[model samples]
Every structure is written in structure tokens, then in C-alpha cells.
Target: MNRLHPLSAVTYAIQYGFLWLWVPIVLVLALGGIFDPISPAWSPIAAPLGFLAGAAYGIAYYYRFEYGITPDTFDVASGVFARRSREIPYGRIQNVDVRQGVLQRLLGLAIVSIETAGGGNTEASLNFVSESEANRLQDQIRRRTAYVKEQRRTKQRSANEGEQQGSQRPTEPDADSSDADRTGAVSGAETDTPSDPTAVPPDRADRTDPDSTPVDGEEPDAERRAYASEPDRQRRQRLFDLQARELLLYSFTSFRPAAVAAVLFVFFLATDPIIDLLVATAQPVGGPQEIGEGTATNYGILTVVSMINGIVITYLLSVAYTFATYYDFELGRTGEDFVYERGLLQRYSGSIPVEKVQSVTVTANPLQRLIGYAGLWVETAGYGPESSGGSQSAVPLAEQSRVHRFTENLTDVETPTFRSPPTMARRRYLVRYSLVAAVIVAAVFGLAQVTALEGWYFAAVVFVAVPPAAHLKYVHIGYFVGENHLVVRSGFWQRRTTVIPYYRIQTVSTRRSIFQRRLGLASLVIDTASSRTFFWGTPTIYDVDLEDAREAHTAGRKRLQSALRERARDDDLGLTVDFT
Candidate 1:
């Protein structure tokens, strides 16, 4: 058993007691009373009082909170008045995360967060522990958890063997009796010869047979055979690794629209302030005539300077953001998990269980494609694409050839040959895109009518692009159903190929909207534990022929069921972890 660091009092006060102390300060300020200590006039006096209060609360909390690790369970006792104690068994623990901010690092301390299976919140958090202690504790917990799981599996195997031998014991008795009689005759032992084998006395026939007995406490041949037939554990293998040059290349290739937009927004915000400063400085030196005479030229020069500054600012911000987020990206395979590590300022170390991964995606934007590189993203059981807010990429950038190798490691399936949707589906895509273009044109025309808008005709020019864009989109929308995986490739500019294992899929359905039905086309929708595609509509194989859609659905469903059966067998053998 151990207590947190002495400085934990300060951390706890800031973390838990800040609200309590600040509320009174806010109330005093709002009331506007000179007598109130936290009022603006008397704020100097309020600081000491708040500090004393925080110190008291922190000390009390430090004394009440305690944590300890037993052989199999991690126990935590915490409370100021109404104490609560929790015990988390090692077997159920899923993640042991350690984090340290600047202040914590300066104090040589870290926070250890323990998360368990099927729980949304952390099971326990030990704050302000020694950094080295946190790391040691995390390692010990993981090692013990693995050891416990192995012991449970061994017990299960032994119990199963016992049940199997018990079932076979009844049939073996008769054969053993005949063998024993033969042995007795050969050894010249006197034995009663019954007219019928069935007429033998039950007590006499119940004697143990030497032939059926295990020698030297060894296992039976049948049990040995069963053990031999069990599947081998997954071997550790390297898939893809990012080097220094590759990581630098990845920074340039990783183009995020959201980030670019943010830079542009910052540029826009800065332009007004800078232009106002220039105008303000010039206003004092110039009369109305002089100002009017040079106003157009001054505005031109300011516009040019601002444009240059904005571009430079955007470039620097983009580079800084990329470097900060993915400074030393690395992905590798361990026995049962794919370990992803990166970050310069705030280090991250996440080990994603291979079996928990639901789907993988190999994607390339225009810039990355030009560099002959692609990125990988994984969707796991709990982390869906929509909710995976950080960089979802497992391999931030790798050569196209390396992508297939990484996928094979994660999926245990080969890169599939994609088959495009029926050519007739192009009409649906074109119609949908044209309708969108028409809506935009209608909005522009309405704007022209309401306001003095110029170049309303220019908006109509967007119709020229609709056909080509729709055609490319149609060409890219393809699906492949492999022996054990489903691959879907889509997108016109930013191409993506998603590979999902059959076992990950939960449902398969063929859908037909009114328009799709009219065109004799249907969508094949495969739902997995976590859907990774970022589409407004369903993540599906859209606008395929009706019969093909049915076939795809049937094939996917059959494979899913087969995978479920295999998983069930693994469960029975105690090979799979029980997350719940």
C-alpha cells in the first residue's frame, strides 16, 4: 500500500477544490461589496483566504485517499467523509495509461489511469505518483494480468479433458475386462470362466486394468492429441516502421482540410487588425485630399503585404501542427497487440489488441498519391470512426507496397482485387450530382433576384464539372468480398480502400430506395462493430445491380456466420479473452 507524492496535495487542491474556492470569489465580485474580501477592491485580501481554504481541503483529501495492489486485485479507497473502496481484478483490466503534464514532470510525478473492460469511465486513477513507480506499476499489472489469463486457460483445458475422459470411461470398462482376462490367462493366473461375459460378478469385473492405466503419471494419448491440435499463439512480426526521412515526408503528405481551413481563418482574422493599424498610422499625417490621392495605392500595398504574410503564417502553422502531432510516429506488432507510439511534447503509447480491431483503411490523398505513399487507419471495437477524434492513422505514411503488408498483418487476409459497380449505376451518380449542382444554381439565381449580385451565370458553370466528378466517383465506388475479408474502395480525389474482417461484421442487408428501385439498383450495406467510413449516408456499397447486391449480402452474411462459429469454438476452448 502506498500514498501519493507529498505534492499530491497541491495537485488535488487544484483538480478537485478549485471550483469550491472560486465560486465564493465569483460571488463576492458579482455582489460588488467593498467589505467582501474577493471583491475587486479587496481582492488582495481574498488570495490568502482562498489559498488557506484550498490547502485545508487538499490536506484532508490526501489523508483520506489510499491505494494498494494485492496479488490479483488493485484496491483504491477514497473519500473525504463517505469513504468508497473499489477492487479491480488484474484479469479484467484492459488498459494501464500513464500521463504527465509539464508541472507533474517537473515534480517527477505522473498520473496512472486504470481502465477495465466494458467500462466507460476509468476504474481507478492514482494521481501524483512517482514517474518511475507509475511505469513499474503499469508493467507489473500487465504481466500479472497475462499470467492470470494463462492460468485460467490451463485450468479450463484440464477440466475439459476430465469431462471428455469421464464420458469415454464407461465404454472402456468392457474392453478393459476382456484385455485383463487375456492377460490373466497368459500369466497362468487362476480365473473363473463364466458361461457368459455378462454373467460375470459385478465386483470382480470392477477391478482396474493395467492396459488402460497411465504410466508414471503421464497423460493419456487422447489428451496429448487434443493438446497437439490446439492452435498456436500469434507470432510477433514487424509490419511497417516509420523512419526519420519517412516521418518527415509524412508531415508534408498528411494534408488535413480542417487544419488548412483553420490557418486560413487565422489569416483572415489577422488581416483586419493589420490593415487597421496601417490606416490608423497614416490618418494622423495626411489631410483629406492627400489621403484621397494616395488611398488606392496604400490599400493596394497593404493588400499585397497582408496576402504574403497570411501565406507565410499558414505555411508555418501547418508545419508546426504536423510536427507537434506526429513527431516520431512508429507502429509495430507485438504478440497480441499493434503498438502505436508517437508525439514529441506529449508522448502517447497505445497498444491496440489485434482481435479488437474491426476494420482497416488504406487511404491516399492527391498529395500523398503523388509521393507514392499511403496512410492506414483502424477502427476498433469501441473507437468508431466518428468518435476517433485524434489522428486515427496507425501508419501515418508508408510506401504503397508496404501498405499491403501491414494490412495482411492486421487482417490475415490478402489485398483483394476490387470489382467496380455496374456501369449503369453511373446514371444514378450523375443524376444525384446534377441535382446538387442544380440546387446550388437555384440558390445563386435566387440571390441575384434578392440582391444586386453579379456573375450569377458563373454559378451555372458548375454544371460543367458535375459530369466528370460524378463519373470519377462512380468509377471509384467498388467492392470486393474475399475469403475472409470485405474490401470497399471509394472516393474520387481522396481514394480510400477499407478492409474489414468477416468476424467484425455484425449485419448484412440489401436496401433499395424508391429511386434505386426504379433503376433496378440496390445498395449492399455491411454493418460492423465500428463503422469507419465518413459518409453522410450509410457506409455501404451503393448503386449496384439488384442481383449483385443480393449476392454480396448473402456472401457476406455466410462468411460472418462462419466467423461467428469459429469464434464460439475459440471461446469454448478458452482461447479468447472474456471482455465482459
Candidate 2:
């Protein structure tokens, strides 16, 4: 039995980081000495007592997650006394996921998840376990179901072969094939047996046997042999099954707004500097006395411990928290669609049928670029702005070559390359960004000059630099459509693009800033199932653009509506004609 879920290491790290599960409560007891400054019992008794209790609770709470699957169903049961179990039939299983967090990657644990056909809730969850086991389980379940299907298919094929061969009885499997089917069940078994699992070719040896004879009403031996796969064909099939296993857990990536939002958490921490500045100015103390006292050193100390320490810890923990919270990631492919299951606490999952995919996009972040990795996004319809917010996705990071190869392999179509507008076309965008930055900087500079916030602090105002930042941000913008996919790429250091399908677009909306209006350009807003916005009517988060923005915005929704109406109209006309 595997002792841990793949997610075990990551979850425990999170428990300690986010909840301070390991930091002993005795730290508080030790603080009593500081406040009292006279207490002597704090060390020998209070500290140990507090530490012991805290450590106990921490250890107990750390192991509270359980997840796995049995032969019949996949499930996860966790929590102390009050446990929850979610199980789904093997056939109904739509997706099974294996995920590795930063810590889990190091510890080599993986969390396995199963998604059913339709759900607005988490159907099953496994907290942590061995990565290999989770993978094996995933393969096992997929195989069990697929193998059963193949078995039925093989049986059907045999029957068809029987019909084609005109055989009275189906062919019996050899001992080796049966054993192989038992071990490989779903996928591998298909190979050991033949692709046409059902057909039976009558043995010619029986015709020569002294005691063997065909039963009455049975077909001729020649007809029975006609339905079976030739020796060469069977060999080819075995090789194909072995080869296809590489595509088993097929890799996936989508434009992750959740990740982007989480990354933008930097802005949240950056706000504290502004607050500190305000507090410093508003304080009446430290006027002239600061020159004689250690106020400068005190500020430096505060910067080192309070500002730097808090910010660094917050940033590190934020990344961990975000991964645990949002990228509770999963990816799997079904009949004609690719499904992505992600998010923490409250899970969110979205699936995109390949036919509906509007585009495939590739992008890179500075950190990722250095290592030759990039982010990928898929844009689709029925969930994007046309309905309310345009549906788009950013997903699994991958190497450029891996993405290219997977695209071609999965779709069975040569990958299509989409080209964007000329770089010069974006000159106006720089102007727009420059003007916006200028307005902000000028206002801040004006306020500083008028308020005397600092004496001749003219040099410090260089922080108002905007032209370079805005220009860099503009250079990264690219938008294009390829095959059935619509793609858009933007962002400066961390480039990103979204590939949304035409039909997954639930809604589409457009927004325009007054400045953009002045330039005779409108912004196109695209939104998807970003959890932050799943309400009715307008979407909460969308991209704003200024092109054929308005018309292109509703293109998907209008097309769908027209198709549905036409379908309805066609059905009604048939009813009125009453040809039957």
C-alpha cells in the first residue's frame, strides 16, 4: 500500500505555511516573559506545555487527507470524524487527473482526481499518494473501462467476422491472449487479443481431425476462416496499441486567468508601500529630532525586518497558496473534447471539444523563457464574451516543441500557424499607454511639489518612468485566428495568449475607455469560467480591444443562435409538410 497521496508533501507544506500548523503555541507563552518582564516560570513549564500541545495538533491535522480508487469506483474519503466520500462508476468517469505541486514534485507524490460527465461540484478527490500508483490507477481505470469496451468491441468484431466468414461458432481465445487481457484489461488486452475481439475463424485442423466434425446447420470451414484478421494485420495492431500508450495521459494547457490573477497578487503587496508612505507623512513626530536620534537606523531596521521580511514571506507563501488554491490542476481527453479540472477548496472544471476550439496559442514568461518553457492557451466559444463574458483559457506550461507536437498528434491534423498584425500597427497603443502613464505621473508629481512631502526630493521622482514600461508591454501584443481557433497574445515580461473555441463562448461583451474612444478605437472584452465571474448577464472579467471589436465580439454567439434557429425552423417545416 502506498503511504502517501502524491499531493501529501505539498498539502502538508501548505498546512504549515498558511496555517502555522507547525509553529508551536509556546511562542505565545514565551511572549509572556516580554510583557511581564518579571515572570520566571515561562521557560521550564509554559514553553514546553505550549509547544507540546501545538506540535500534537499540527501532526494530527497534517495527515487528514485520504484519496484513491477501488476496482469498481474512484473515490476520496477525508476529514477526521466527519468524512466525505465521492464515487463514480468506471463507465461514467469522464476524466482522471494526476497533479504535482512544487513540493510534491520534490517529494514525488501525486494527487489523483476523477471528474464525472456533468458536475458543478467536486465528484471525487484524493489528497496525496505515490505518483506512480496514482498514474497506474489512472491507467487501470481507463483500461478497465476501455478494455471492457474493447472486449465488447472484440466480441462484436468476432461476431461480424463470423457473419463475414459465415462461421457457425466464434473463435476461442488461446490461453496466452486470455492471460494478457486479464493483466492489461482495458488497453493492453486489446493488443494481445485482436482488434476484432469478437470474430471466430474455424480451425482447418479440426477438418483433418479423425474425431472432429462440424455440427449440423454449422457454416462451412472456408466461410468461418474468412472473418479472422490475417497474421500480418494482427501484428500491426499489437504494435499500434503499444505505441498509443504514450498519448495516454495526454498533456494539456489553457490560458489560466486564475494563475494570472494570482501572479498579480504582487500588486496587492505593493500597495503596502503606499500605505507606509502615507503613514510617514501623516505622523507629526520625527520632525527635527530624527537628525539627532537613531530614527534613520530604525527606519532601515524596519525596512529589513518588517518590509523586506514580510514582503518576501508573503510573496513566497502567495505562490504556494495560489498553486494549492487555483492550480489544483487536472487534464484529460474524452471522445472529442479535452477537459481541464483545476482550483482548490471550491473546484472548477471546463471541457473543450476539439471541434469547437477556435485557436491554439503559445506564450512565455521571463522566468519560463530562460528555461525554454512557455504557457499555452486555448480559446473557445459558448463560454466567452458572446453570451456574457468571452470564454478563454491559459493552461499547462510546456516546451514549445512539446506543444507543437502534441497539437499535431492529438488533433490528427497538421498544426496551423496564426500570424498577427504588423508591429507598427501597435504604435498608437504605446501612445495610449504613454498618455495614461503621463497623466498619473504628472498628478503625483504635482501633488508632491505642492505638499512639500519631502525637501527637494526631486531625484526620488524618477520612479515615475513609464515610456519604457509601456513600450515593452505594447511590443508583446499579438492577435490572430487559425483554423477553427481564435488566438490572442499579450503581456510584457510574461507573455500570454488565449485560444477559445467558437461554441464554448457562453457570452461576449465589449468595453471602451474614453481615451480609446477619442482615438476612434473600441476594446473587446472576452471572459470565461474564471470563477471570479460566473454570474448572469455581463461577465466580471474580459479583455478590452479596439478593432472590429464590437462586431467580432458577438460573432460566435450570433452564429450559434442562427444555427439553433435554423435547426428549429427546419424541424417545424418538416412537421408541417407531413411527408410521412
Best by TM-score: 1
TM-score of each: 0.73, 0.44
The total number of steric clashes, by the backbone 3 Å criterion, in model 1 comes to: 0
Q: Which model scores highest in lDDT?
A: 1
User: Tens digits of per-residue lDDT for model 1 on 233-343?
Assistant: 122244456787877787766554556689667658897776565555444444122324555445445546556655666666666667766777665544345555566
Candidate 2 per-residue lDDT over residues 128-161, each given as its tens digit = 6565555545544544444344455456554554
Clashes of each: 0, 73
Measured over all alpha carbons after superposition, the RMSD of each candidate to the real structure, in angstroms, is 12.7, 16.3
Score residue 479 of candidate 2 by CA lDDT: 49
Clashing pairs in 1: none
Cα lDDT of candidate 2 equals 0.46
- Model 2 regions more than 4 Å off: 1-87, 91-122, 126-136, 144-292, 295-361, 367-373, 377-464, 527-547, 550-580
